[model samples]
Structure formats: C-alpha cells, structure tokens
Target: MSEQQKGPAGGGPGGQRPGGPAPGNFGFGPGRGGPGAMGMPVQKAKDFKGTLRRLTGYLRPYRFSLLIVILTAVLSTVFSIVGPKIMGKATTKLFEGLMGKIKGTPGAKIDFHYIWEILAVLGILYIISALFSYIQQYVMAGVAQKTVYGLRKDVNEKLARLPLKFFDSRTHGEILSRAVNDVDNISGTLQQSLTQIITSVVTLIGVVVMMLTISPLMTLISIVTLPLSFVAIKMIAKRSQLYFKGQQKALGELNGHVEEMYTGHNIVKAFGHERKSVDKFNSVNEELYQSGWRAQFVSGMIMPIMGFIGNIGYVLVSVAGGILVLHKTITIGDVQAFISYSRQFTMPITQTAQIANILQSTVASAERIFELLDEKEEVPEAATPIAVVQKESEAVPGKAIKARGDVSFNHVQFRYKEDTSLIEDMDIHVHSGQTIAIVGPTGAGKTTLINLLMRFYEINNGSITIDGVGITQLKRGDLRNLFGMVLQDTWLFNGTIRDNIAYGRTGATEEEVVAAARAAYADHFIRTLPEGYDTVLNEEASNISQGQKQLLTIARAILANPTILILDEATSSVDTRTEIHIQRAMNELMQGRTSFVIAHRLSTIRDADLILVMNHGTVIEQGTHEELLAAGGFYADLYESQFSSRKRQVDAV
Candidate 1:
C-alpha cells in the first residue's frame, strides 16, 4: 500500500476498522462533515436518472407485472369515482321521488326503483375497486421480491470477482452494510412503493377529471391551491432527500464501529480502554440518532400540511355552492356533486404527501447500492479467457494435486504502490522440497517478498515464475490453491471444525479432516472442546485460546497439504511449549514441500537448508547456520544477541 494508505482508511487484519461513511458523508465525497439537518446532498442529485435507469434494469424482467400493477391501480381509481357518483345519483333521485310522491305526480311510482338500481351500482363499483387493489398489491410485492433477489445475486457475484486490493482499500463494515442493510431497505421500499406511487398518481388524475365534469369553475377554485402544494412538496422533497441520505450514511458508519468493537473487544478490555471505546461508540450512535430525527421530521410534515390545504379547498367549494343555490343558478344535486368532487381533490392530496416520504427513502437507498456495484473492480479478464488446463480431473482432489513447487524470482523489484522499491534487484529460487528461511531486521522487506510471491501485490519490475510459468499467466485462484499458508494471525470462519479444515478441498471426507488435525497436533485440544470436530468457531474463534486457534489454522493447511507452504511466523504468538509443538507440526507439514519461514525468533530458522539474511532490500548473507556463523556477519550478530539472552534466562531458572 502507499504510505498514505498505510496509516488510515484501513490498517490491517486485527486493526482493520471496517467501513462506514465518513462524518461529512452525505454523498461519496473526497472530503468529510456532510450537512446536519439536510440529508447528504448527493454530488449530483439532478443526474440521479442514470442510477435510477440502471436500478430499473433489475425490474426489467418483471415489466409485464409492473404494467399490470399500474393498470390495476388506475382502473381501481377510475372505478372508485363511480361509487361516489352513484351515491349522489341515489340521493338526488330519492329527494325528487319524495316531492313527486307527496303530490301523487308522474314518474314518482318508479323513482324508488331507480334509487335502488343506483345504490346497487355503487356497491358493484366498491367491490371492483377493492378487488383491483388486492391484485395490484399482490402482484407488486411479488415483482419487488423477484427484483431484489436478482439485484442481491448480481451484487454478490460482482463482489466475488473483485480483487483483494478492493478489500484492502475499503473497510469490511461498508461492504457488509451494502450486502445486508442497504439491500434490505431497498427491498422493503420496492414491495409497496411501486403500487403506492402508481395508485396515488392515478387517483389524483381521476379526481381531477371528476371535479372538471362537475363544474370547471369550482375545479379551478380548488386547484389554485394545487400550485402552493406543489411548491411545498418540491421544497420538502429536496430537504428530506438530504437528511435521509445522512441517515443511511450514519447507519453505515455506526455499523462500521460495531464491527470493529465486536472484533477487537478483547484487545480493548486487555488494554483497559473500555471508557475510551464506549465514548467513541456513543459519538457515532449520536450522529445516527440526529440524522434519523432530521430526516423523519422533514418528511412527517408533508401529509398533515397537504390535508390542511385540501380542507381549505373543501370549505371554499361548500361556501361557493351555497351561494349558487341561493341564486337558483344550479340544482341541489349539482351542489352536492361539487362538494363530493372537492373531497376527491383533498383525499388524493393527502395520499400524495404520504407517498412522497416513502419515495425519498427509496431513492436514497437505491443510490447507495448502485454506488457499491459500480466500484472499479480490479483484474478484469478477457471476454473469453484462455484456459491453460481444462480437464475435469484437474478440479478433483488427490489426482489434482501437484509437486511442481519450484518458485523463482528473477531480478524482481517491488514497491507497495510507490516508485521506491522495497525489494530491488532481488533474485531468489526455491527448488522442490527446499526449506528456505528469509530473515531480516524489522522493515527489511520480509513480508513484501511473501506478498509478491503470493501475488497479493504486483512487482513493479522483473518476473516471478512458478513451475516454469510466469505467475501472471496462471489463473490467480488456481495458483494460490497450490500453496498452504499459515500466518501469525488466525482468521477462522464460524463453522464446524471439519468445515473450517476442509474449506479449501470442500468435498474432503470427515476422516481427512481428523487425520489432518492429528498431524498438526491440534486434535488433542480440539477433542477437549465441547463439541470437538463439530464445534463452531464463532467470530474469530472466540471460544478457543490464541494457541489453539493457530493450531486449528495449521490443521486447515495440513488437510490441504499443498506442494508448497508459507509458515509466516505461525508460532510467534504462542508460549514456549506450544511453540515447540507447533514447530514440530510445521516440520512434519514441510517435509516434502518447499517452504519459506519468516520468523523473529532466531532459534527457529537455524536448521533451515538456506538462510538468506536480509537488510533493507538486499540479501546481506546467504548459507547454512554454521556457514553464517563462520562468516561473522549480520546473522551471527543476531544469533549472538538471542543466544546470550537465552543463557541469562537459563541461569536465572
């Protein structure tokens, strides 16, 4: 990594802080404090269509259902208008029938029948509207679920293809939030928003049409208030979008903190920094709280305010209609229908306010999810990649394993994301079954060599070849499987002991798992555990000791039994007795495989076939232990310091 990256963003395994949006993170920005009350204003909110258009691609497969849902909502709204109109007709005819019946006038005998027919029509309209609503909701929910399923699947597949550098650059919390929380928010919104938005729109249009049919003059009077509502809605939408974006970003930050604390709880407790940790958590939690309140407060005002404005329109319609009646300019039925039409305007306006709040949240979540999927992935392959080996047998276990353990670095010079090389003009070769120890003072490119060999980072110059092929020519996944690595840091998944051991060769039998455990000297401790081989190691193997965790990792590699192994100071963290046992296990595992050991303990690598003493980027000394001791170079001095220290400790004992 670059020097800039080395300190912040993400540290490393144990120190990896995970990911959250930064404090000023309303939108993805170069700098951090986004707004407080305002949602994180997207960098380019006006250009959100591109993201929206892309998100709509997930729903493309459900286009037919989408159409059906929309049409049903519109049809339901249109049919709903028929209900109120029918009721008005029944009321008008019943009143006229009373006057005619009192005088025994003509058409009075049939007026009662007409009223019943009108009432029946209203009942039919109500039933049809309810049925359409049911179909629309059911179909919309199904479409939403299917769309979310497709979206989740695509995001997962894309994430899997991203290079290790991507993870190196971002925190685990950010990625986790995108996978679970962000995707979940989107799914919930889609389930109902698609129908609700359509229903609200169709109902508004239907109401406007019915109001015009009753009287255009009264409709105009009611709709003048429409302009004021529109302005209010747009203003609120802009403000709410900012806060909702802040809420989501805050939640992402909070998630990152929780992930870090949970993973490093032991470290915090051991360091006696409980108060410090709690204070940090509270600060993040408070930011989340503030963002949620601001977003909710802005969105919550829309519904009630729209209702108030719509009510004013309703009152105006009633007053105007009473005047028209006094002047004998319109019938009582016209006045009654106009009042009902005024109600139509008010109800839809209220619904619009409710739908707008939901729509803002949906947009915010969609924006965040799209941002992740669009992250630049490293190591993209050809549309039709060349396959060096394609045999089905190559994928199978024992038959698939190889012994071509030769690894050579020819004039290899590397730098981690910089021009100055960490390992310059370095040439090394490991023949099959050779035990090569790479020793150096601190900051002498020890880890960098292994990283280059593992292809975790690319060399700026020179070639690294394994088994007569340039490492770049090989598929990364296939190449890594050939080498078993045991690092000082043990990262075990939450699964059965057998599951963790057989993770590489997933189809390996239970017997293979136990055999590998026994070889690594891990079986004794594992058997003593509550469930033994069936035991689950939750979150970094919390239930086990550090020594046992390292042992289990060794057992995992032992089961794979690669032709080459990297024992990266695997025994560094254990006690003397445990280290000895681990060393013994390492010897057994490395017997027929090429191995590279990076160790701080000078005693451990003394018996290695070749010991290359490194200083800065160059190998200062190279030979057997006796050969180095005779030369009286850097290794001799390092050995003398440890050797004298051990003598003093033994004397004290």
Candidate 2:
C-alpha cells in the first residue's frame, strides 16, 4: 500500500496510534513561536518621505481633478465663513430699532426692509456653499478610487514576480493583511482626510480675519488658548502613535493564528487537542483587544480636550465683547459677530487636532503597503533567450538550434542560510530518456536538487545545463516550459474537473483531456461522479479523496506532455491497489522522456536506470538497485530494512 494510505504501523489516516507526534506539534515548534508567542513583528518604514513620495506618484494622473477639488473646497468654506457676519448685521439693526422704539423716536423705527434683504443674501450664500461641497465630494471620490485601483494592481503584479524565498519566509496571513487591511486603510484616508485638511485650514484663516475686523482686543483674547491646545495634542498624539503600531501588529498575529488553526482543524479534533488550539488563539486575541482599545481611547481623547480649550476661549471673548459694547466703542452687532467668529475659529482647531491622530494611523498602514510593494523580485530574464526545440518535427519555423533533455549538474553548491549547507559538491549527469531515482533519509537534500534543476533557487556556485546550454542563458519562462512537475501535495483550484485538467495546456481539446485521464486511471472514477468531468470541486478540493486528487494531478501532468518529468513522492499517498495503477500510468508518462523521481519506497524504483543514495548533503552511493545490493552499502541497508519489514508483515497476514 502507499505509505500515506496507512498511518505509522498500520493505523488509520488519523494517526491515532501511541507513538505519533502530538497534534499541537504537527508542523510547529518552539522556533516557530509556538503558542506562547506575544505577537507578529511589524516592519516600520524607515523613510517616511520616500514612501509618501512614491505613493503620490500614483496620484499624478489625477492632478487636474485634485486641483478642482481644492478650488471647490475653498469656495465652499469661504461662503460658509461669511454667513455669520451677514447675520450679525441683521442682529444689530433689530437691536437699534428696539432701542429707538423704547425712547419714542420718529426715525428710529426698525429697518424691516433692510433686514429682509440681509436674510435673502444669507440664504443664497448657504445654498451656494452646499452645492460646492457636493461637487468637491463627488470629484474627490473618483480620484481616490482610481488612485487605489492603480496601487492594488501594482501590488498584485509584484506578488507574481517575487522570489520563492520571500514566500517561504512569511506566513500567508501576514501577506494577506498587508494586501487587504493596509490597502483599505490607505483608501479611507485618501477619500476623506485630504479634502478635510484643505477645508479646515481655509476656514481657520477666514474666521480669524473676520474676528479681527470686529475688535482686535476680542480676537486676541479668543486665541490665547491656542498654544495650550497645541501642547495637549502633541503630548497625546505621541503616545497614540505607539498604540496604533501595536494594534496593527496584533491584528496581523491574530490573523495568522486563525488561518493556521482553521486549516488544520481536522487534525486538532482527531487528536483531541481542541483546548490547546483555543488557548493559543486566546493569547493572540487578548493581545489584539488590549492594543485596539488603547489606540481608540488615546485618539478619542483629542476631540474633548480641544473642545474644552475652545470653550475657555469662547467665555473670555464673550465677556470682553460685552464690555466694549457698554462703552459704546463698538455696536451690539460687532460684539455678536465677534462671538460667532470665536466659535467658528475654534471648530476648525478641534477638527485639525482630531485629524492629526488619524494621520498617524494612516501613515502606519501606508508604511506596511509600501513595504510589500518594495519587496525584491525574481532575477531578471536574460537579454537573449535560448529557445527549447525538443523534437525534429516540432522545430520552430526559422530557429536552427534545438534542445533535448540531457541535464548535467556540475559541482553545484547550495545552502538555505549562510551557516548551514544543504548541498555541496554535487555532480550528476542524466542522458536523454533516462529515469534517475533519488533516495534519501528525511532532512537529506532530496528536494533541493529539484529546486536547483528548475532554477527556483540559484546555486551558490557551479553550473546546471540542458542540452549542453547553461539554464541561466535562457529566460525563466522558457526554461520552465520544458518540464512538468507533480509533487506529493495536490493543488486543485475551485473549478470544474475539466477546467483543472485543462489548466495543464491552454486551449486543450476535450478529447485530449479525456485521453490523458484514461491513461492515468482517473477516467473511471471521474465518470462515477455525479457530474462526471463537470463536477465542481470545493475550495481545497476536499470533496475528492486524496488518492483521487493525486490521479487528477497525474492526468494534468500527462496532458502537459513536456520533454522532462519530475515526480516527488507522487504515489506515496494512495492505497496499495491505487499505487499499482499510478505506477503503471507513470511508466507510460515517463516513456521517451528524462524523468527524475524522488521516492521513499525502495521497491518502486527497482527498475530505474540509476539510483542515487544521498546522506549529509552528498551522494554516498550510486548504481543500479541490484548492483547496490551486491555492494552492501547505504542503499543496501535501506532496501533490506524496508523490504524485510514488509515481508514479515505479509507472512504474518
């Protein structure tokens, strides 16, 4: 039977036997920040100006629209600012009329006609102000959406071009938070905050000017609290900045925990480790809650504190304006105007203070988005690419050169980290149409060879060539097109079975897909499904059995029809009967091709052209299975232990 079909020592797929690793330690360890870790670390942008400048580059295309928005915002704020002064004129006229009537004066009657005229002007100004506000909001919305759309597109493209190492070193949830959460934060700031800044500044200047026109003494009194307001905001905002950073980091860690737990929920339940998973999640969740509330509480304090300072300024202005009126140095209308201006002036100050706190959080989010956009991409393609021409009949119309699958790795050296070598001084040669099997213990450099051959990771030293031409001379896309790979982990998207199979070759015919499935022994089960080839798989393809999924992947590789094939533990996760069928299918697929097979089951590769036994990052033995057995080296020992153990089991059965 395939090793995956049986748990260790003939147990079920749940691995419920006594000696299996605990579920909590399935794929995590102390080094991975196990359950007790605090939170995910955040990457803060060191160069804020550089990041902002690059972000604005995306906004360059909408400069004319932004200019219109600015003009409309100024117009609206100016109209709104002047309305109070006009209303103050009407108040003064009414007050004079009242005083004249009380004294029984003939020409002191209230100017009702003039009062109506002032009211009409005030209404007109308000209507114009509202109209401009609407126009500015409408225009700015389009600008913000377009700018963020461009940013999102750039980020998505950058993800496709990043190196494999970048993904290997980070979790999926961490990357997703940057893509989704951080980007949305930037969008909100752009849509709302930018125009608010323009309006607040303009209103503040206009209110101060109007206040001065009535009485400079009252205006001076109103602004005495300005310095105090600034001091409070500065102190509070510095502390708020730290909390905002913590909140963002905690959110990322929480997301990572959720993603990992849900993905492995089945194993957690099977092994009765639900409590452990929940406890780990609670630790991360508690951290997030603490940071989130602290950030909100600090930011929330700004508005009320600014309002208190503004109220103090209002009381002082009111008392001073009344004394000036009593002295007959200013009209009642002027005092009323001064008080109205005082309130208007302070409103904008409160708004600006609130915006400052929001701006800090926005900068934190933008820094994250910029960090992702600035990640290192894959190595550049060669200036001149060498094309692969596999068969004489398949030659291009004008290209004279041809490529065959004769691979050679000469003295290749590689290490994941600088201090630890994974492979060193490795040399191998495979003639065209040869099947080379790789055998090794766990942690040996089995898959590392495939990574180098595919150029997923460049070797530290030495050269790997195909058809006597170095792979580095060819474009990555052109080189990858020459081989098809099927790993142990099957990846099937949420789509119809037919679509998944056709993913191998673009625009493949229905007949070709069916033929490939039939050869891989997957056609029988596909037909038995309710929708046959039209069956739509769920997310993660959980609707199908593991063995069935492996068959479908094999069918896909067959349809690709590459000149070289790579199968890494391909048949390890199936039943014994299914493994036999898969072996027969693989033999057919590997015909007339240079194939590399990495397998743990020694019996499966007994007929291979060559077997390479690897240990400690170097090949210790190399020969045919029978020749290695006769020599009694490392390969012989591995083969004897596995087969002898299996023989005893069969005899007992």
Candidate 3:
C-alpha cells in the first residue's frame, strides 16, 4: 500500500541542522575577544567544603601514610626554626670573650672549644631537617598519586555510562580537557600545594613561639606589618583570580580549535578555507596571550609586595633589638636570634599567600572534572533482564525459544529537542527473513530511525520489540548483540588490519578472521599491502584508501554474523567494480538474515522484498520496487530523478 503524510520536521542534510555555525565556530560564536569568547565559563564549586570533603574521601584509604608525612613535616620545620636561636647563643659567647680579651684581662681568651661545640650541633640539626623534609616529600608523593589514580578511574568509568546525548551536546576537545587537563591540575595541587600548605603553617607557628621567648617587644614589631601584607595580598589575588579563570577558558577554546582544525584539514583545504582557519587560530591565540600574561603579571606582584612588607618588619625589629642590647635589657645573642625569627616569620606568610592564589586555579579545574563526572547517565538496564537466544538450526524440543529476527515498531514518537518532533505515530513490521530498503531525501530522519532501533537515543514514546519481546525488557548489551551494522563513515583504530577485523567477535580465531575478509572481497587487497594483514592503520586510517577502509568494515560486520543486519550507505565510497563484488558478498551474508539497507542510489535496492519511502519523518510509501514505480508517486519521482542524474553524468564522461 502507498500512503502520504505531513509533519513539522527541522533536521537538515545528514541529520544535522542546515545553515548552522561553521566548523571554525568551535561552539563559540563570532567576536573572538568578546566576554564569553575570550574564555570558557569557570564553574565554581557550589560547596567548597563539600567538594573538599569528597576529595578527602579519596585520601582516606591512605590516612596512615599521610599521618606519617604530616609528622615529618612538623619535625622538619621545628628543627629548622630552632637552629637560628642556637646559633645566636654562640654569637653572644664569642662577643663576650672578644671584649674581655681586648681589655687584656686574665683568662679572657675567646672560647674556641665552646664555639666548636655549637657549630657541631648546628650542623647536625640542619642534616636532620633535610632528612625529614625528604621523607615527607616521598610519602606525600605516593598518597597524591594514588588519590588521582582513583579519580581518573572514576572519570573514565563515568564516561562509559553516560548517554549519547551528552556527547552530542559537547565538543570532543571539551571532554578531553576535563579528562586530561582538569585531572592533571588536581594531581599537581595535591602533590605540591598540599605539602606547602602544611609546612607553611607549621613554620609560622614555631617561629612565632620562638620569637616570643627571645623578645616579646620585637615580636610585636614584626606583627605590626601583618595588616599591610594581607591588604596587598588581598587586592592582587582578587585581580589575578579573574585573569587566571580567563586563561583557563581561553586555553580550552584554543585546544578545541586545534583539535577540530587538524582533524578536518583535508576538508578545509578542499574548500580553500586555510586562510580563514589561520585567522580563527590567530584570534584564539591572541586571547590566550592577553589573559595568560595578565594572570602572570598579577600573581608575580605578590612576592615583591610581600617582600617589601617583610623588609619593613625586618628593619624595625633589628633597630629595636639593637637598642635593647645596648641598654643591657636583652643580650646580643637574644637580639641576633630575634632578627632571624623575624625573617622566618614573614617567609611563611608570603608562601601561604602564594598558595592561596594557586588554589583558585586548582579549584576551577576540579569543578570542571566534577561536572563531567556528574552528567546524566543512560537509562539503567532492566531489573530482570531477558536473554536473547538466536537459533542457527532446528530448535531442540526442550531448549529456550530462538530469536527469529522479527521486529516491530509500534506508535513510536521522538524528537531531538523539545521543539522539533521528527518522528510521530510511526508503525512498521518485518518478517523473520526479509530485505527492507529505506529511501528518503536528505534530512528525512534516515539515520535517526537507525539510532532509535539501536537504542542510542530512546524514543520519547511507544516501544520497539525484537521477536515478541519489548526491547526495554532486554539488556542493552544483549539487544545490540543480535544485530550487525556497517555505516558509511568507517571507524578503524590505530591497529593492524587483522586486529581491526577481529574486533567484531571477541576471541575470534585467525582462520575465522581470514574467512570473513575473503567473504567481503577485502582479503586480496589486504594481501597486496607491504605488511599484509599486519599492516597498521594510522590515526583515522588514512594510510589506506577510502574504498579499502569501507571493505574492511564490511569484513568486520560479516565476522559479527548477527541474526539481523543494518547497512547505511555501506558501499557508497567504492568504485563500480568494487561495488559489484561487495553486493555479491552482501547477498551471500544476507541469505537467511533480516536486512535493512539505507541507500541514496535507488538502483541498489530494486530487488528488495520491501521498499520504504520516507519524507520528513513519516513513512509515505511501502511496496516492492516495481509496485512503487507503477504507482507514480513520491518513490517514482525519486527513482526517476536519480536515474536521470546518473545517466547525464555518465554520458558527459
């Protein structure tokens, strides 16, 4: 029967929107240095305490080791802090002895023996401090690495569970940035900044305690500079935070541009858009440069500003201590020690200020990583999954029923977005063994239909069934195992030809792989290669011809050997002679299987048992090829147009 239907549909050619942004857009609109274009949005953690708590959960497993690291950091800082005070004692002893000797008093010689003892003690303390510092670093390294290992593992697992819609909405580079750059930033902060924070706090506390013992007045002088130091830090850090966030966003955009342009270099050159591409790159690069230097310059100001504040404190303490020593209110040794503690005091404050600045960037990175981990995942599997059993031969009397390849779509409705209703009230059925060819114009929802069948995107309403069981009742993995697919865009990893073919069926034997290749008419050409079946495909499989890649994918599908087969323009890239051979091999493979073919070349499916004509998103006509041609409808017009176009091209040649 033939039918006609009308609906509102909006997808463009090849299931993409027509008149969409160009590839150079990179998901960021024009005005490269504009507010949003200058950088990616920084996602601040909603609850800093909660995020820190979650991050610390990863550290709980190694708490004992971390405790030892903390202890070592404390010991190292304490030992270093005590050294300056002890050295001051030796300084006072020498000064007293020199004054006595210059006055020519009896038994007034300098105490070389006491000085040697102090020097020996100071040397031992330095060595002990260094040893403890090394130990703290070693232990913290292991803890930091282990924590990030768990984080990276969780992110990867979360990626596998996420639905296809999540991927469709994001650029590949954005996802990769989260996985690589964001996680790495967390790792670096844990490894270095965590330890710095611990040491700075401990050193600050120990120096303050020692300084009080030497001269409380001198300590008060040192404390007066704190407000000025904090004010400078607060102002500079506030400004730098904005630039740092901008720097990260610009970096991600630049990375996205590089990845997209390099992957599609051939297309850009073919369209003579190289100059345009270069201009896009320059725009992004300039934004990155401006943000990066501003961030560095602002952060760089912190050290010097803190240093100036520290020197002001140092000179004040020194002058006050010197006056007190002259009045005999404090020993020269005490004054010397107070000056050393004053210097030590400001060092930790400066370091702590810098650490605060570093943490801003670190938190921004962690937020990005957490965002990816929190994406909505695919629908959960059935609580009670049904098994799919495919029967190869006559069924045994007591065995489970076999999957017969009968499929049905009942009142299905779907849309990519809320505004676009692409499919509505669609109904279809196929017998156990039938060849159904689907024909449609560009953007007619051809690929969308295949996506629903495979459950890549769930239908908004209705149900699809395999045999007599609804697909939702079956585990997605089990449902997918029942079908074999070959698409127009071939996907091959960076591996040998043999490895690519064997990927169809896990643990497939070498002989089986070879047989599959031969059946697809790919074995002869593979043998002619320099490395035969061992020839390696580069990234994107560019080392091989497009026809060869298509053939290899067919071989992969043949090896899968499912009860149902789906081929979407599978042979569109091959030559006429190669197409003939592929058609013969596919015919053999489709002997007893249910086959669904989608083709733009109407000639390819003339022999199909059923031909489906679709427009917009509805199935308008269904019948044998001859029956549709006699009806003089949409199918007839489509067939005639393609036929005439091909004839004109051939005649011209």
Best by lDDT: 3
Clashes per model (N, Cα, C within 3 A): 6, 0, 1
C-alpha positional error of residue 152 in candidate 3 after TM-score superposition, expressed in Å? 2.3
Across 435-458, the per-residue lDDT of candidate 2 in tens digits comes to 999999986788778778877778
For candidate 3, the TM-score is: 0.84
The alpha-carbon deviation from the true structure for residue 235 of candidate 3, after best TM-score superposition, in angstroms, is 5.5
lDDT of 2 at 452: 80
Q: RMSD for each model, in Å, please?
A: 6.1, 7.8, 6.9
Worst 10 residues of 2 by lDDT: 1-10
- Between candidates 1 and 3, the one scoring higher on lDDT is 3
lDDT of 3 by residue, 1-653 (tens): 00000001211112311122211122343211122221222344567766777777889999999999999999999999999999999999999999898998899978989999999999999999999999999999999999999999999999878876776776665677677666776787788889989999999999999988988898899999999988887787678768867776777678768777887899999999999999999998999899878877776787788788889998898899889988998889888888888878877877675566455556766767788888888888889775445555444565545778888989999998899899998899988889999999998878788778877778999989888788888777777777787777767777899998887888889999999999989999999999999999986688998788878877887888888888778778889887887787788778898988998899999999998888899899999999999999999999999999999999999
* Alpha-carbon local distance difference test for all models: 0.73, 0.78, 0.79
Clashing pairs in 3: 40-249
The TM-score between candidate 2 and the true structure equals 0.82
Compute the lDDT for candidate 1. 0.73
